[model samples]
Target: MEMVQMLRENATLLKLGYQFELPGPRMAATGILTRNQDQQRQKRMQERKAEEVVEQKSATSSNQEVPTRKIAEMVKHQEVCNKAQIRKPKTKKLKNGANEKESEDILKDLRNNLKPSVKSRHEASNLPPPQRSGRDDLMAAIRGSSIFSLKRVNLT
Candidate 1:
């Protein structure tokens, strides 16, 4: 029993090849360095295992806490409040070759004419082909029927 107690007490000193009261500071430093290295290795192994577990969790994200937001709660589109821009009419006068005037009636008449008109079934059939104004107005493209297929027949 006495021998076992002595051995247990001197275990660290014995491992460092020391005799009688732990030799010098150099030997003690060597032992400490080796122990520190072992601890560092264990720490590195634990970090590697932790990284692997995190990778697995990320790979299976569906079952885990999915960072989600309800699509319905989000505003899909916001109403665009366009600033009213009153464009100057290209024609400086009325259709009757009148002088330039900034009357409200003239402006209102011009605005009404500029707006696109949706033709009904009967109106579309009777609508005449729009004149190619060479401008980019959408109304210029609205034609009743295509004139390409209409060939003039001479009944002579």
Candidate 2:
């Protein structure tokens, strides 16, 4: 009686309609709650097993339809290709026309300078070529055979 009075003092248990029943033949009715919980758990397990078996059957059926599946994949690929844009390849022209005159003059001067020296093997020496300052003006002066022309020749 004291335990029942103590339990009844709890506002939460009273709100949830909890009954403080004594241990006796009356307690046999509580076995229904345990049986209900077990039944719900068993139902959920059977549902999960059924779902897995259904998925396995669908997978096996899809494998059997392999030819149709390939045709569907090819159709999807064609749709993707059609949605994309086809572009023309880019091309560039290589022209050396502008420097033709300058190159020809340089070639003529180099030929004139090398020919006479090649004929006379006594002029050949194992000395390094002379370095030049003021690159543009000096290179033009040497090519034109102007001032300091012999000292400024470009060696190969």
Please name the candidate that would achieve the greatest TM-score relative to the true structure: 2
Instruction: Report the Cα lDDT for candidate 2.
Output: 0.64
Clashes of 1: 0
Question: What tens-digit string does per-residue lDDT give for candidate 1 at 38-85?
Answer: 767788999999999998888888555643454433433222222223
Error of 2 at 79 (Å): 39
lDDT of 2 by residue, 28-114 (tens): 334444455566778899999999999999999988967987889999998888666354345443356546677778889998987
Q: What's the true lDDT of residue 70 in model 2?
A: 86
Local error of candidate 1 at residue 50 (angstroms): 0.5
Residue 10 displacement in candidate 2 (angstroms): 27
Tell me the TM-score of each prediction against the true structure.
0.24, 0.30
Model 2 lowest lDDT segment of ten: 7-16
In model 1, which residue pairs have backbone atoms overlapping below 3 Å?
A: none
Q: Specify the highest-lDDT model's number.
A: 2
